[model samples]
Target: MRFTLKQLEYFVAAGETGSIARASERIHVSQPSISTAIAQLEKELNVQLFLRHHAQGLSLTPSGRTLFQEAKRLLEQAGGLYAAASQMHEEVHGNLNLGCLTTLAPMILPELTLSFTSAFPKASVSPLIDHQERLLASLRRAEVDIAVTYDLRLSEDVTFQPLVELPVHALVGENHPLARESRTTLKELAALPLVFLDLPHSRDYFLSLFDMDGLTPNIAYRLTQPDVIRTMVANGFGYTLVNTAPRSNVALDGRTLTRVAIDGSHRPMTLGLATLTALRQTKLLEAFVSHAKSIISQGYIPGMMAP
Candidate 1:
């Protein structure tokens, strides 16, 4: 009761983030500052709010869970008052912690600033580009406000809003044997050396495409980064599977890569926005989702297999 609004704000950030360090990074505050705030908050409330898990980061205690809801509601009320006073025709304005899949970051994130931030200039975006598992984990932990990523391995706690369907395509170098072909089958693609973009469920998803055709790809190399895989494929290293349809055939090093349409019964992955189902929707989040939907609808967002 004696704690200030700042304390509650910090507490909520810490609880949602599940890590004082990540909370500090996301909010642009020092770790020690949040630590001090948490201490003060606990002292004033006379209940332990977090359980320190050493290197694994913090987890909310039972008391913390109960208090988190109240803290969030109070913060929303306080924020509404602040926004009301600001006027300027109230629009979504706040620091939104955003997560983009590493592969999609190149295509989606760049447009985010132009489409979303340009409209809501008052909003500040803190973007975290990572893999699928990490993005979903961040959402569940409340580390990220919203995530723009593919629907991969989503748990019950997460909600996925599909923006566009980016189907699986074969990426090959200009000089590759299959490069000249306008379209090819998954079976034909499997025979070539595969520069597999190995990342958790993504690797398996690509393999599943081959399985659909009853053919297993000869995965010659396994790399983590999508750009790296593109570079390798562009340099004639091997063929690879990708959902992101790069607008240009150029790679980082100015190499020309070609995407050949598949002639098989392979399932395509959807690029969507993922968020925690339990979190109360905020104006900032709604604005971002709206902007994203518009981007996809308008064909502004890159990496779409042209319809």
Candidate 2:
């Protein structure tokens, strides 16, 4: 009346792939073996995991869905466990789900991926890029093991480890009048037309920068994508505020753009890594954190400038 790990593994594969035959082919196990394992799993759990049709394959029942999530988690944890144990030999082997802030993704994630993957050959890295809210949600749901983002609207359920500091700066077209300034003030920049990056917490951060000075931007355009904001600024539509500086001053239209320093009083945004407090500190996560800390500390991460 006991189901084995093999049964659970096969059951999960069948449930996910939607057919015992496909699961068999995918796992390189015989079809009959997969079926028997699934049958044994159902009997041991005293629940019907799937409803089968003549040729249509299989569909999960309510119990099957519940077990599917748990089984997937367990399998991931099992992989992590073996990988963790393997770290003694200076090798990392596991699957990691990484989330990154959409704005910082271009600057940081690539650096992390190139170095981390090269160092750990057996490890697989999957990326999920989104806003702070979405990234935090993924961390809570265990959909992401770690996140690279700014410290915005964070709750106590997650921990943010500060990595680098990138203060807000003004982006303007090369032809714009402000592009000639060596340093500018919030009030001075507020008077110009603003093409805002209207993302979740990021928007709030940009808008909140003016609070101390009692200034507000002259709203001209609103957008979600970062590149579009840059393009807008390059086209001379309006100026925009952003954290990281683009590696190139040229926009998509081949027009040049420029970033001028803001006054010293403005607060800088801190880039950090976030992880759920509830998730255990696995070796894989620790390795990633260590590598990230090394990268940031060395000052090689592109687009990010030290305060």
Q: Count the backbone clashes (under 3 Å) in each candidate.
A: 0, 0
TM-score of 1: 0.70
Instruction: Assess every candidate by TM-score.
Output: 0.70, 0.70
Score candidate 1 by lDDT: 0.86
- Off by more than 4 A, model 2: 1-90, 303-307
Q: Per-residue lDDT of 10-105 in model 2, one digit per residue for the tens?
A: 988898899989999899999999999898888888899999988999999999999989888888898899898776666567988999999888
What candidate 1 gets wrong by more than 4 Å, as runs, is: 1-90, 298-300, 303-305
| Cα RMSD (angstroms) for every candidate in the order listed | 19.5, 17.9
Model 1: per-residue Cα lDDT at residue 62: 91
Q: Show pairs that collide, candidate 1.
A: none
Worst 10 residues of 1 by lDDT: 298-307
Q: Candidate 1's residue-wise lDDT over 53-142, tens digit each?
A: 979999999999999999999999999988888865556898999999998898778777566778998998999999998998899889
Clashes of 1: 0
